[model samples]
Target chain A: MLDDVVFWVLAVVAVAAGVAVFRVDSMARATYALAVSFVAVGLVLLLFDLQFLGVITVLMMVMEMAIMAIYMIMFMGMNPALMPMSMVHAKRPSLAVAVVTFVVLASGAVLIPWPSRRGAPASDLTVSLGQALMGSKMLVMMTVSAVLFATIIGALVLAVPRGRYDRLGDDLRGRVDADQPDGAGQ
Target chain B: MTLQTVLLVAAALFSVGLYGAISQQVVVMVMMGLELMLNAVVLAAGGFWWFLSPAPDGQVLLLVVITAMTVEMAMGFAVATLLHRTRNEDMTDMATDLAQ
Candidate 1:
């Protein structure tokens, strides 16, 4: 009984926040909303007894949003959260496509006949997951990890323009502090 | 009521997010859209886990997905920051200059 209530409440919150991610006018606001939505979903995952995934989701999103906030501050030079900049563009086509996709997918979800239970249920679900992943999907996991590493390297190369010595001088004892080149960093 | 309902909800959320990614001009908005899709993936994984059985594998896959989301967002921010440095604007359309 309580589970049903919790599930519905969470589902509503998650979906609402997901909508807010697009509805909000500013970039920072949308990012925060998305973060909230993910956290809510993480909680729902917990309610479903997926403890490992739920906790990881919360941790991961918090860190991701914090990093995003930093970049917003560093780049936009305004409170990206408060700005009323319109993030939307090309709205009519987007809305049409989104609605059509939703209808088809939702219809399938409601109408399709899913596979029913077969064979005896496993006593330990986590163990079953481990066995399946290790047995069949091990390569997939490795590929994902490798891709993540490459992304990190690529980001670093793009973001950092030059080493510390380039700006601070060879001895790192330059008067570049409080000095503005082209009046940047204001 | 059933797994299909949950999966449908996930699918709707994913499509909505995809639209946002395609429609938004700002980099941050695009990232928000990506996060939305990742959230849907999490939901789908959970639904599979529950309906399939009590196996912890769905949960584990979700853990990996969450981790991937984090790494991707971090790198995305770094790229955005770089772009902002080169050009003071955050709109994707303004990022076309590739020359010194």
Candidate 2:
């Protein structure tokens, strides 16, 4: 009873915010809508007893949104606050495609024969997860994480315009903060 | 809640995401759309794991999906940043040429 009600409420909030992501005028507002949408979805995940993932989702999204806000300021500095820009294109065709995709997916969700519910989960779900991570699944987890690290370095290299030569002296032996040409690092 | 109900919610979220992804011309907006779609998939997977299977494997898969989604957005933003820096533009239409 209560679960159903909460589920419906959060699900509606999530969907509403998802729609607002595009309908809103400013880019910052769209990011806020997306963050709200995910937070609602995280709550729904918690309602479904996915405690860890739900919390992680909330944390990760908050941080991600902060990064997005910074990105907005970093790149779109023309209007300062409003952005005063509308970037949408091919409105009619996109709307048609969206409507068709929604109808097809929603109909499939309603009509398809899904699998039956299995037995209850283990008493200690987190313990089992930890054990699996340290056991057979260890390699995959470790490799994926290593790849994630590599991607971080790669992304930084690709995105940042400055390097050791620009920040430090030509010998790469400049002081921590004072040796740059611009005196801005200090 | 029933599995069907959860699945329906996921579908709705995915559709909204699709709409945004298609209609938006800004690169970051498109990435946000993709994030929302991936968010729907994560929730749906959680629903199936909770209501249908109660399996640890599904949870693991869900985590992987989450990781992939995060990495994808990060990479996308990196590319957007690069494009903005060099080209001083961030619209999808402005980024049409690949031969550069």
Highest lDDT, which number? 2
TM agreement with the true structure for every prediction? 0.80, 0.89
Return the clash pairs for model 1, or none.
A125-B54, A125-B55, A125-B56, A126-B56
Angstrom error of the Cα, residue B58, model 1: value is: 3.5
- The per-model lDDT (C-alpha) reads 0.75, 0.83
A74-174 per-residue lDDT for model 1 (tens digits): 66787877887775678899888888988888888778887774344356555665666677777767776788888878887777776455666789765
lDDT by residue (B1-100, candidate 2, tens digit) is: 8888888889888988887798888888899989999999998998889988986777677788888888987888889988998898888889889547
The top-ranked prediction according to DockQ is 2
Q: For all candidates listed, what's the TM-score of chain B alone?
A: 0.90, 0.95
Candidate 2 per-residue lDDT over residues A5-41, each given as its tens digit: 9999999999999998888778888888899999998
Task: Supply DockQ values for each candidate.
Answer: 0.56, 0.73
Chain A TM-score vs. truth, each candidate:
0.75, 0.83
Give the DockQ-based CAPRI class for model 1. Answer: medium
